[model samples]
Target chain A: MTGITLAVPSKGRLEELTREWFAANGLVITRPGGARSYLGAIEGLPEVTVRFFPASEIARELIRGNVDFGVTGRDLIHETSETGPQSVAIARPLGFGNADVVVAVPDAWIDVTRMHDLADVASDFRSRHGRWLRIATKYITITRQHFARFGIAEYRIVESLGATEAAPASGVADIIVDITTTGSTLTANALRVLEDGVLLQSEACLIVSRTAKFSARRRAQLDSVLSRLGAEVSL
Target chain B: MTNAAFRRTNLEALVEAQGATRATPPLLLPADPYFDLAGEEFGRRLLLTTATTGAEYCLRPDFTLPIVTDYIANGVGQPAAFSYLGPIFRQREDGPAEFDQAGIELLAQPDGDVALDQVFTFARAALDMFGVSPNIRLGGVGLFEALLAQADMPAPWRSRIRHRFGHPEALERLLKRLAVSHDTKPQKQPSRADLVTDITEQMVAAGLSLAEGRTPEEIADRYLEKQALNDAHVPAETLALLHEYLAISGPVLQSLTRIEALAASRRLMLGAPIRAIRRHLNGLGEARVTFDASFSPRLDYYTGIVFEMTGRTGDVLASGGQYDRLLERLGAQAPIAASGCSVWIDRLEAEFRQ
Candidate 1:
C-alpha cells in the first residue's frame, strides 16, 4: 500500500510542539527512546509515517520529495533556495516558531534607516574604497535579490556560517543580513536593524512537495490527516 | 564531497573530449567574470579582498555572457566552441552559497536554430546523467509581441500589454475581459486625440518644447490630472474588446492563425523577428510550448525568450533566455544575438541526494 511520509523536527521545543499539534488533531505522536531514537509515529494515522529530522533537513527532504510532506519554517525554505511551483505551502502560522530575516548595520550609523540607505552606503563604499561593500549573512540569495531591486550593482557578500551578528565588529564584514525575533542579540553586538530592512517575516508552516508521487491510498491518507487537523484547529 | 568531485571530473572530461573533436580547447574561466556580467541581483556571492589593487569579485552567476565575451575577445570572427564547469553562487534561504553550473557556448553559427536544438539536447543529456527526466515546456516572446501589434492599441497601451503578457494572472485577467461583450459605459473614456491636443497646448503654454522628453501621453495625463497613461487605464469597454482578441493567443501553430486573423482585421503587419520565431516554434515538434502574450523576465536584460524549468517538486532548477541587448550595454559595438541557460546546480544536487 502506498503511504505518505511526513517529516517532523526530531527534537527541541519544535519537536514538543509537533507532538502537541498532532495530539490536538486527535493523533498522538510518540518516540519511545526519546533523544537517541529518530523514529516517531502519529497514532491513528498509521498510513502516515513520521520521520524525525532537524528543521532544515525536513525542508530539504520535502523539496527533494524524499518525504511527501513536512513541517518546517518559512525562513528555512526561503534560505534553502527559491521556492518554485513544485512546492506548495499547505499551512502557515503553525504557531510554534517565528522569526524575521533582516538587514542590520552598526548602531553608530544612525543615518542609515532603510534599504535605500544601505544601497547608498554600498555604492559609496565601493567608490571610495575601490571595493564592493561587504555584507555577512547566511541568507545570500535573498540578500542578493533584495539589493538588486535597488540598482545597487557593486557589493560583496561574505558567507557567515555562524555568529553573523558579530561580523561587523569582528572585522569579518561591513554589515549583516540575519534573522532576529528580538533586537537584543543585535543590540548586544552593537548592530541595529534598519527600518524597512526586514526582508522576510517568517513562521513555521506545513509544506507539501508537488513532485512527490501521490497514489490514491497516500492521497486519501493525507486528506484524512488534514481533515482531522482541520477539525481540531479553530479558524 | 567525493561524489560531487567525481561528478565534476567526469563531466569535465566528457566535455573536453567533445571539445577536442571540434578542434577547440576547453575554455576554463574564473567564476568572477560570470558574476560581473550577471550584474547586481543575478551574481551569487562576492568575496572581499585585502589586496589594495584587488577588486571584490563574485562567483560567476551565469556562463553565457562571459563565454560570449571570451569568444568576441579572443576569437573574433572565428567559429569557437567552449565549455566550462565551476561552482556558482546564489543565496539559499536555508543553505550555503556555492552551486555547480556547467555549460557550453557555440559562437558564429550560421544557423541559430541548429544551435538552439543542440543546446536543448545538451540540457536534456545533462539532466539525464543526473537521473532527472524533465518535461520540456516551450513558449516564444516574439509570437506574443506579434499578437499585441494586432490589438490596434496605442503604443503605451501596447507596451503595457506586452510587458504583462507572460504573467499568468495578468494574462488570464486580460483574456477573460477580452472574451466578454462590453455593454456598459466606461467610468472614464476620454478621447486620446483630445488628450494629446490638450497636453501639447499645455506644454506650449508652459514654454516647454515637445522635444524635451515629454511624450504626448505624458502631456495628456498632466491635463487630465492622472498618472502616466498606458493601455491599463483604457475604458473597460475598449479593453474588453482588446482582451477578446488577445484571449485567442495559443500554441505556436494556433497562435499563428489567430495572429494572422488579428493582423487582417487591424490592417497591420507582423515584424520579421515575430515571423522567424513563429517558423521556429512550428518546427519544434511537441515541445509543450505555449505562446504567452505577457511573459516578462524579472531580469530586464532578457531581450527575447525567457524561460524557467521547474522540477516536479516546484523548484525552479534552471532559468535562462536570450539577452541580445546585454552585450551592447557591456560595450559591444553591435547587438549580439545570443541565448544561454544556467542550471541551479545546488537545487539539482539536492534533488539527486533525495
Candidate 2:
C-alpha cells in the first residue's frame, strides 16, 4: 500500500507548535526510534509516515513535491515559490507562527516614512554614494516584488543569512525586509517599519504538493489528515 | 574559456569580420558596487563576500558593464566595436552556475536602420553556427513609451509604468492600480486648467518663479496639464486594449498591422514610433525576425528593440537590445545610441550536444 509522506520542522518552537497542534486535533505524532530520530508517525494512523526536517527545508520539500504535505511559514513559501499556478497547494492555515514581513530602516532616516520616501532616499543615496542602496533580506523574491511595485529600482537585495534587523547598524545594508512577530526587535534596534512597507503578513500554513503523485491510498491518507485537522469544511 | 572560444570559431570570425577588437576584463568583480543595479535575478544568483576580507565579490556576470566601464576609462570618445570570449557566473536551477560566453558589444552606433541591420547581421551569424533556423521575437521598451505619448496619461503614471516596463508582473500590478484609481478621482474646485491659468496670472503679478530653472507660469502650466490628464482618467477599456496590444505577436508585418489597428481603435497616435519600428524591420531586409509587442527583457536598461534568438529546441542562444540609458549612467557624458547582443556559448554547445 502506497503511503503519503508529511514533513514538519524537526526542531525548535515550530516543532513544538506542530506537535501541540497535531495533538489538539486528535493526532499524536511520535518518533518510532525515540525523540532524537527524524523518522516519526501519527500515533494511531500508520499509513501517514512523518519525516522531520529543518523548517526551511520543509518548505523546499513541499515545493519540490518530495513530500506530499508539509508545514511551514507562509513567508517562506511566498518567497520561495513563483507567482503562478503553484506546485504546492496552500491547503490549510494553522493558527500559530504569525509574522509580518516588513521593510525596516533605521529610525534616524527622518526624511523617510513611506515607500515613495524610500525611493527618494534610494536615488539620493545612489547620487551621494555612487552605488544603489542595499536592502538585506532572505526574502529576496518578496522584497524584490514589493520594491518593484513602488517604482523603487535603485536598491539591491543583500542576502542576510543572520540577524537581519542588525544589518543597518552593522553598516552591511541600508534597509531590511524581515519577518517580525512584533515591532519590538526592530524598535530595539532603532529601526522603524515604513508606513507602506509590510510586504506580507505571514503565518503557519499546511502546504500540499500538487505535483505529488497521489495514489488512491495516498489521497485517502491526505483526506484523513485534513479531516482530522478540521479543514474538511474548506475542502 | 579559451577552449570554448576555439569551439566557437564561427562566432569569433563573425566578430572579427565586423571589426571588433578583443578585450579582457578583471576576474574579480566588486559585488557591492554592481549588485544593487543588476536586476532581481542577477542579484539573487551572485556569489558574495569572500571569507577573509568580508568584501563582496562575484565572478564577472556579463561583458556589457565591463566593456562600458573600460571604454569610459580609456577615453574612447568615438564609437567602437569590441568582442570578447569569457566566463559569466549566474546561479542556475538546471545546470552549471558558471559557463563560457562569447559576444560582441557595438557601442555608440547609429540607431534605427543601422541598429536593425547590425543586430540582424550579428544574430544571424550566431544562429548559423547552431545550424538552426530558430524563432525570432522582437520587442522594444520604447514601444510602450511611444504608445503612452499618444494618450495624455499623467506624468507620474506614465513614468511609473515606463520604469516598471521590463518587469511584466510589476507592470500588471501598476496597471491594476491605475484601473482602480479611475474610480477614486477626487473632485476638485475650479477646472484644473482654469486654476493653472489663475496661478500663472498670480505668479506673474507676484514676479516670482519656482525653484531651479522653471518659471512660475511653466510650473503652473505643467501641474495643471498633469491634473487635466489625471481628470480624464486612464480608463479600464484603455488598459484592456493595452493587454490586447501586448498580446499581439507572430509575423513582423502581421504584428505591425495589429499595432496600427490597436492604435487606431484606441485613438492613440503611435504613428512616429510605429513607423520607426517599421523602418527597422524593413531595414533588416532578408533577416528572418518576428515582432512580438509583448517582449521585454529582465534587464531594465534596454530601451529599444529587444530580441532573443532561440534554437529549434527552444533554447535562448543569444539575446540583447538597445541600452542607451545604461551608457549615460555608466559615466557617458550623455546617452549613446548603443545596442549589443551576448551569445551563450554553452547553450550553443548544448544545441549541438545531441
Candidate 3:
C-alpha cells in the first residue's frame, strides 16, 4: 500500500515540539539513518511515513499536494498560499509558535488611541511633515487590507527586512506592522499597539492539501494517523 | 492588433491636427527619486524598478512627467503640443499591468479654457474612432476644494478630505466627519477618568513603556481631543445639504443646475470651475456624449476637471483630466494650465472586434 506522507520541520524548537506532540499522541517515529535522516517511519502505524523539511516549506509542500498533511505556522500559509476550501484545509491547529501580527505606533502619540484616530493622525502628520506616513512591515498584503479597511489612505508601506519594530526609532518609518510574541521588542522601542490594531493571531496548524488525490489505503492511513494524534477531534 | 494600430493612427492624427509633434520618451527612468514625491498611491502602482547607484530606478509611470521633463530638459520655453503612442506600466491588484496608451500633452497651452477644450475635443474624437458612444463624466475636484475652502473645518481635515475626492467611500466618511463638530473648546476641569489606569502599571508589565514623545498632561489632552468627537454633531440641515450635494448624479447640465442651487443656498464659491466647465461643454456643442456629475479620476495629480468615458459594460474606455498643480509641483516657473486625455488601445480594439 502506498504510504501517506506526513511533513514536519527538520530542526529547531518546532522539530522538538512536533516529536514530543507525536510521542504524546502515542506515535513513535523511527529512522534507520537516525538524527540527520530526512525520511523516517512512524512506528505502530507503518503506512504513515514522515518527511522532514524546513518549517517554512512544510506549508508550501502541503499546498502543492506533495504531502498528505504537514505542520506550519498560520502566518506562513497566509503569506505564501491562496488558501481556501477544496485547496488546502487546516485540519487542526497545533497551537505552538504563537505570534500576533499587529500595527503599532510611537507611544508618544497618546492621542492616537484608535484606528480612526490614527487615520486623523496620518493626515495631520502628512501636512506637518510633508510626506505620507510610512509603515514598515514584511506583511504587505495584510497591512494594505487592514489599513484600507480603516480608510487610512495617506500612508505608505516600506517593505522592511528585519527588526521591523525598530524601524520607527531608527528614522526609517513612522510606524510598523509586525509579528510579535512577547511584545517586549515593541515596548523596548517605546511603541504601543492601537486599541484595535491586531490583524491576526497566528499559530501552527495541520494542513491537508486538496490538490493531492488519495487512494483508499493512503486515505485510511491518514485517518488512522490523525485519530492517534487526537487531532481528529478537529475534523 | 490591427484595430489597436488603427485606433492609435486615428488618435495620433487627431492630436497632430491640433498642432502636436509626435515624440517618444525612453522606457527606463530613475524610480527612487519619484518615490518620495508621487506619494504612496502612485508610487506603489509603478511597475518596473531596478537597483542603481544605491537606489532603485523605474519605468515611466505616466506620460505627463516624462513629457514635461523632456521639454524642461530641452529648454523648450515656447508653446508646444506633443503626441505619443507607447506602453505604460501600472501595478494592478489583479491581471497584467502593462498597457498601451495613446494621448497628447500641451505645453504653455495659452489658457485653461482652451487647453481643457482641446483635450475634450481629443477625447471625443478618440472615442468616435473606437466607434463607442462616449459615456462621459466630469468631476470638478477643484470645485470641491473651493467648496472646502469656504468650510469652517480645520486645515488638516480639509486637506485630507480634499485629496480623497476620487475615493468615494473615504469621501463619504469625510463628509460624515464634517457633519459633526469636533469638541475642541477647553474645559475648566479636565476629567481624571480618562487616565484612571496609572502609567506606572504599564511600566511594570514586560515589553511596555511610556513614550517620551508626549508628557502625561499632553496624553491627557489627546484623550480630551478624542472625547470632543463624542459630542461633536453638525446641524441636521447642513448634513442633509451635504448629502444632497454628493447624491446629485446625472446629465452634466442638470447636475450643474443642482450644483448652482446648492451653491446659492449655502453661499459656497463654485463660480470659477462651474463657469469653465459650462463654457467647455457649450463649446463642444452637443457631441455624442453623456456626462456623469459624480465621477473623479483616480490619478491624484488631477487638480481640476476629471473626465472618463465608459463602455456599456462600465469599463473605462478612455480617461484624462487637468493637472495644473502637477506642473507647478514639477518645478514649472509658474502654475501652468494643462489637460490631456488617453485612449486605451486594447479596449478600442475589443470594440471594433465586437
Candidate 4:
C-alpha cells in the first residue's frame, strides 16, 4: 500500500540506538504523531514509512511479508522461520544488541565440556534420573535443530520465559539453551558454556523477507533507504 | 486395489490371522510421552495445541506410542496383539500432514524370533496382497550392544556408543573422540556425597531457587561420570575392529559370518545375540531381505531388530522393529517382551500408482 514499510524496535535503548544509527547515516526519522505514536517517516524519504514494533513482533511481521524490512535479532529470525533460513534473508548486521545463543551447564559439573559430552549426559539422563534431561530455552526450533544434528534425542525442553540461565539452579531444567550478551549472568548463576556449544552468534540485523512481494517501485524505495544508511545490501 | 478395500479385506484378514485384535487409540494424546520417549525432532513435527489446563496435546503422530500406552494401561496379564488402521497426523515438508497407516503391536510375546517372524510375515503378506514387493533392509540394536559389551569400554563410553548406534556419522564422530585420551585438569575435588550439597549451596549463593533444577545428587553423579570418562580411552585396536564391524553389510547370513569372524579375531566372545540374529534371519526364509550393521529406526526406542520395507524409489512402505525398552520407558512395571510393524497405506498407494 505504501512505498516501503520499515519496522524498528518500538521502545527503549534499541529504539534510541536505531534512531541514532539512521541519523548518523543522514536519514532523520520523525514520529509524525509524536513519541507515543507507532507511525513515523523519514525526513526526506516520503517513499519509506517507518512503523515501530516490539523487536520479536518485527521478526514475525517480516516473516509474514507484512513489512518490507525489519531490524530484529538474528536469533529471532532463525527461531521464527518455520520453513527454514531461506524464508528470510539478512540485509545487514547492525552490530548492536550482540549476543550468542549457547548451550550452558552448571560450572560445578566440570566433567562436561563439549556437545559430544552433552550427548553422553542426555543419553544416560533418563535412566539415571527417571526422566528425560530438561533443557530450558525460548528458542525451541534452534535448540531442536542443534540437538538433532548431534543425534541427541533423549531430552525434553522446558520453555523458559524469563531468566533462562537460572533454569538449571532453579530446578526447572537440567541445562539451558539461551542467549547471553556477557558471560557474567552464566557465571553468576554458576554455569559454564560447552566448548563447542555456541549455536548462533547474533546481533541486530536488517532482514528482508524473501517471500514478500517486492514490486519494482518498492525495490527502488528500499534501495533509497539502504543507500542513505550507507549500508546497501542487495535484497 | 483401492487402499480402503485392501485395508478392509486383505489387511484385516492378515492381522486377524495373527490374532491381533482391533484397537483404536485416541487421536489426541498428552504431548509429554512423545517428546520424552520419541525425542524432540519427532515431537516438533506434531501438530500441537494446549488445553485450558495448560497441558499440551498433539494429534497422534503415529500409532506406536498411543497403542503402547493403551496396552500398558488396560492390557490383560496374558500376551496380547493389537491391530490399528487409521490416520496419523504429523507436519510434513513434502506431503499431507495426515495419512493412513495400519500396524500391529505384539506384547508379552516371550519369544523374540517368533515375534519378529510373526510381524514380518504379516506385514509382508499385507504388502503382497497389494502387489507391492519392496526391498527389505534389516538391522538391530541388540547385536551392536553385544559387540560394544565385548569391546569392553567403560560404561559411559559404552552407553554413548550404544546410543549413537544406527547413526553412522555420529558414531564415527564418537569413535574419533573416543580414540583421543582426555586430560583431566588438576584441581582439588570434593567427595561425591559432599559435591551435591556444595553445588546446591553454590546455586543458593548465586540467588537461585533450587526447587526446579535437577536434583543436586544427579549433578554430582554426572560429575563423577565425567571424571571416569576423562580417565578412559577406547583402545585403538578395539576402535579398528569396531570400524570394520560397522562396515559389515550385505546379505543377512553373510553379514553374520563377517561379524563372527571379526569377534573371533579379537578373542572376544559375542555370545548368544549374534547367533540369535543368524537364526532369526535364517528362520525368515525370505529371499529379499538384507542386513545393515549400522542401521536402526529413526525413533530411538528400538532395542533389538529393526527393519524397513522400501519401494523401488526408496520410499519406505512399511517399517517396524523391536522396542523392548519402550514399554519400560512408557512406565511398565516390568520390561515386557514387545515388537511389531506398521504399514503405510498412503505409501502403498503410491506404489500402486507407480
Candidate 5:
C-alpha cells in the first residue's frame, strides 16, 4: 500500500509547536536527510510519511486531497475552501496558536463601535468620498463572507502583504479585518476591535481530508495514530 | 416560444409612444458601482474580470445603473426619459447567464405622483402588449421608515433599526437582543461603581488632572449615557406594533386600511406616508395589486414604491422601483427623483413556452 502522507507547517513557531505536540503524543518525527529536508517519517510508524510545508500550503494540500491529513490554522482551512467541512473535517484543535479574525477601525471613529454601525459609516464614506470604503486584509475570503453576513456591501478589499495594522494610518485602507492574539499590535496602531466584530476564533487543528481515498489497512493505521495522539478523530 | 415578432413591434412601439428615447448602454461597466449600490450579496452574482491596468469590469447585470449614470452625466437638469433593449449578463441559478431585457427609465421627474403614474403606465402598457394583466405586488421603504420614526428611542437605535428593516431575520434577532433586560446579565460586565474607580485610576496614571479634564460629575454623566445607549430597548408596545406593521400584507387597499387602523390604535403618526401610499394605490384603479410591508427588493437603491408583476404561472415578468438617491450615490451632486420598470424578456419567453 502507498504510505499515508501527513503535512505539517515547515517553519516558525508553528513548526516547533507541531513537533512538540506530536512528540508529547508519542510520535517523534525524524528528518533522515537533515533538518532542511522537506520529507520525514514518524518513528515506529513505517507506513506514516510526513511532509513539511508552510501552514497555508498545508491547508491547500489537504483541501486538494494531495495530503491525507494536515495540521494548520482553522483560518487557513476556511480561507482555502468555500464549503467548510465538505472537503475536510477537523479532527481536533491543538489548543495553541490561538488568534481571532476580527474587524477593526481607528479608535477615533467613536461613533462606530459595532458591525451595524460600520455599515452606516461605510455608506456615508462612499457618498462623501466617491469610492467604496477600502478594507485591507490578507484574509479576503473570510472578510467577504463576514461582511456579507452583516449586510455590509459598500467596501472594497485591498490585499495586505504584511503590517496590516499600519494600513489605516498610512492611508492605504480605511479599516482592517486582521488576525490578533494579544491585540497589543492593533492598539499600538490606535485601532480598536468592534464590540461584535470577532468573525472567527481560530486555532491550529488536525484536519482529515474527506476527499482522500483510504484503504482498509491505511484506515487502521490512521486510527491507531489518531488514538495515540489523543485526537479522537472519526475518519 | 414568445412572439418575437410582437416583442419587436409592440413593445418597442409602446415605449416610443411613451416619449422615451431609445438608447443603448455599454455592455461592460465599472464593477465597483454595482457592489457599492447593491451590496456584496448581489455583487457576488456578477460576471467580473480585471484588466491588465487593474481596473475591474463586469458585464452589465442590468440597465438601470448604466442608464442612470448616463442621465446624470448628460441630462441632469432636464427631465429625461430613455428606453433600452438588450442582453444583460449575470450568473443565474436557473437559466443562462446571458438573457434579454427591456425597460424604460424616467429620470428627473419633477413630481413624485407624475413619476409614479408614468412608470406604472409603462408597466401596464408593456403587459397589455402581451394581453395579460398579471397580479402586481407593491412594497416601499418609506412606509417602513414612517412607522419606525414614530418609535420613541435614541436616534442611533432608530437609525440602526431602519437600516436593518430590509433584512427580516437580522431585525428579528436584533429586536430580541435589545428586549432582554440589562439586569439579567449581571456577570457579563464589571460593575458601574468598579468601572468609575478603574477609570479614575487610569486617568491619574496617564497624567490627566481630573479638574483640568472632565470632572467626576461629567465623567459619571457620560458613563450613564453610555449605559443608556448600551441598554437601549424597544418598548414592548412598540415592538408589537412593528411586528404588526410588518405583518400587514393583503390586497393593497385592504392592507392600507389595516395600517390605518393599526396606526390609529398605536397612536403612531404615520399619516403622511399612509396617505401618499393610499393615493398611489387608488390611482392604480382596479388593477390587481397586493402589498407586503417586508418586500424590499434585492437592489438596495430602491427608496420607495417597489413592485413586481407575476404571470399566471407564478413567473415574475417585470419588476421596478423608485430610487431618488441612486444618482447622487452614483456621483451626482444632488439627489435626482427617478423611477422605472424592467420587463424580463427571457422570463416572458419562458412563460409563453409553458
Candidate 6:
C-alpha cells in the first residue's frame, strides 16, 4: 500500500534520459498504456513507484515533500525557497540538461560591464527620469536578492511570462534577466550580457525529501536502488 | 541592620547619586514597522493586538527601532541612556511565547568605540552580579576583508568567498581552491582510484580503520573529509614563509612591526585600514587574542569589528558586530556605528545557578 514516490520529467530529451539512466542500472521502466500513460513502474524494484510531471512541478512537489525523490534542474531548486530540511539535493550533474541564467541589457550600452555599473546607472536613471529602473524576468526572487546586496533600492521588477530577452528591445523593461545557453538570440536582439551578472549556472540534479516517511524495509529497498544507480553511473 | 544592610544602603546611595535607574514599558508595539519593515516572517500567527485606532499592533520584535523613534520625536539629541525589559513576541514551537530582554542604548555619542567598550564592561558586570564566568572571543569583519585584499583575488571570487565564509564546509572548499594555483593545468577528472587512495591515506593519518566496507554515501563523506584535511594541513615551511610575508600575529605593540615586515617581504602595501586595525588591537593586549587567518562570520551587515563571547560549556553566550550601514537602510543620513551583544539570559541563568 506504501512505496517511495519518485517523480521525473514527463516529456522531451530529459524524460528519455531519466528512463535510460534507470534502465542502465538494471531498473527497466514500463507503463501500462505505454506512451499515453503518466504512471509507470520500475522493474525489479517494486517498492519504487514513478509519477510523471514537468521538471519544474517535480521540483515543487519534492519541496512540498509529496515525493520522496525527484529529478529536476538545479535552477528550479534554487529559485524556490522551499528547500533544505523540506528537501535537499542528493546528486547533481545528471549530464542531460544545462543552462545559465544571466542578466542582459541593450548591447548599445557599452559602458556597462558589471553589476556595479548597473547599480550606478539605476541611481542615475532614478535621479534624471524620476522612475525606478525596470527589470523583466521570471526569476523575480533571484533578481531582487541580487540587487538588494548592492544597496540598489530604486528598482521595479516586471514579471515576464516568456521571451524575457525581447523586453529590453520592445520597451517592456530597461533590462532583462533570462536563461541562455548561447549568445546568438541575445546578439540577434541587440542585447549583451553583463560580465558579472550570471546568477546561476545550473545543471540537472536528483533531489530527495528529508521529511518523507519510510519504513525500514522500504528504506533498505531504496538504498539498494540508489547504490545500483550510483555504480552504473561510475561505470 | 547588619553588614548586609549597610552594603545594600551604600549601593542604593551610589545608584541614586549616579542617577542610574530602570523601568518597564508596555510590551505591545505598532505592528507596521515591526512586522512589515522589520520583515517579521510569522507575526500574524504569533502576535495578538488590541484594535486601538482601528489599526492592529503587535509586540515589539526589537528594541533599536522603537528607541530611535522615541529619540527623534522628543528632540533629545544630547547624550541620553535608557533601559528596557519586557517580553517580545515571535513564533517558536520550542520556546516560550513571551521572553524577557534587558538592554540599554546610548544615543548621540561621538566615540562609538568608547560606547562599545562601556557596553562590554556593563554586560560583564551584569553577568558577574549573577555569578557567571563567561569567556570572551574577539574577531573583526575587517580582518576577513583584509585577507581578501592580501590574497589579490578577483572581485567575483572574493564576493563568493565572502558570502559563503560563514558556512564551515563551504569555507573549507573555497580555501582549498584558493590554496592551489589557478593557472596550473587543470588536473584530469578524479577517478575512483584517486578517491580511494586519498581516503586510505587519510584513514591511516587519522587512525581510522578500513576493515569495514562503506556505502557510497559513507565513501563520499570520507572523501570530503580527506579533501578538508589536505587543505588544512599546511607545511611548517609554508607557514614560516606565510608568517614572514603576512606578519599578522605577534605581541600587541610589535603587531605593526610584524605586519610591515610581512608586507615588505611580500612586496604588498598594507592598506590604511589595516594600520588602523593594528592600532586598535594594540590597546587591547594581543596576548588575550589570536588572529585566525581564515576566520569569517555569516552576518552580512557587519562592516567592521565582530566578536563572540563564550561560557565554560563552549557555547557562545553573546555575539554582535559593528553595522555602520544598517541605519542607512532605515533612512538615516549620517552613518551610525554601533556594536552590542545579546546575552543568552536563560542559558546564563541556568549555568550560573548550577
Please give the distance, in angstroms, between residue B23's alpha carbon in candidate 3 and its true position after superposition. 3.4
Per-residue error (Å), model 6, residue B179: 16
- Worst 10 contiguous positions by lDDT, candidate 5 chain B: B206-215
My TM-score estimates for the predictions, one after another, are 0.48, 0.70, 0.80, 0.90, 0.75, 0.55
Per-residue lDDT over B1-354 for candidate 4, one digit per residue giving the tens place of the 0 to 100 score: 466575557776776677777888888999988888877878888889999999999998888888788788885357888888889998876434888888889988878779888888877887876777768888858888778887866766777777888778788998887778667664565798788788778666755555544556767888877766667667778889888888888888788788888878888777577766666665456547788988986555677788888877688888887888788878887778889999988788777767
Per-residue C-alpha lDDT of model 5 across residues B1-354, encoded as one tens digit per residue:
447686667777776787888878888899978877776667767889999999989998999888887777775779888888888998764433888788888888788778887778787777766766779899968788777777767766776677676677767766776777675442355555765676566445433344432334444444455456676666777777777888888898899889889988888787787776777776677789999998886445678678888887787888887888788778888888888888887777666655
Which of the two, 3 or 5, has more TM-score?
A: 3
**lDDT digits (tens) for residues B1-354 of candidate 6:** 324344334333422332223434456777655433322122323465769576767676656567655655566446655555445665453433655445555555677666566556555554554455655554546655665555543333455455544444545444554566444443444665655666566434433334422222345443344344434444344334433433344333355456556656756655564554554454443224444333335445456665555666666555554555445434556656655544555555555546
Evaluated against the true structure, the overall lDDT of model 2 is: 0.73
The digit string of per-residue lDDT tens for model 2 on A44-83 reads 7878899999888887787777888988998887787554
CA-based DockQ, model 6 = 0.02
Q: Candidate 3 lDDT, tens digit per residue, B24-97?
A: 87778777546655655556677655564566666776676788777766765577788877888877655337
**Global fold similarity of model 4 (TM-score):** 0.90
So what's the TM-score on candidate 2?
Answer: 0.70
Model 5: clashing residue pairs? none
DockQ of 1: 0.08
In terms of lDDT, model 3 sits at 0.71
lDDT of each: 0.61, 0.73, 0.71, 0.81, 0.78, 0.58
Model 2 CA lDDT for position A75: 85
* Candidate whose DockQ is highest: 4
lDDT for A93 in candidate 5 is 96
Each prediction's number of clashing residue pairs: 20, 0, 3, 5, 0, 0
TM-score of 1: 0.48
Which ranges of candidate 2 are over 4 A from the true structure? A1-15, A25-72, A77-93, A102-136, A145-154, A158-176, A181-201, A205-235, B1-7, B49-51, B110-116, B179-250, B257-276, B298-300, B349-354
Instruction: Kindly report the docking quality category of candidate 4.
Output: medium
What value of lDDT does candidate 5 attain over all alpha carbons? 0.78
**Which candidate would rank higher by lDDT, 2 or 4?**
4
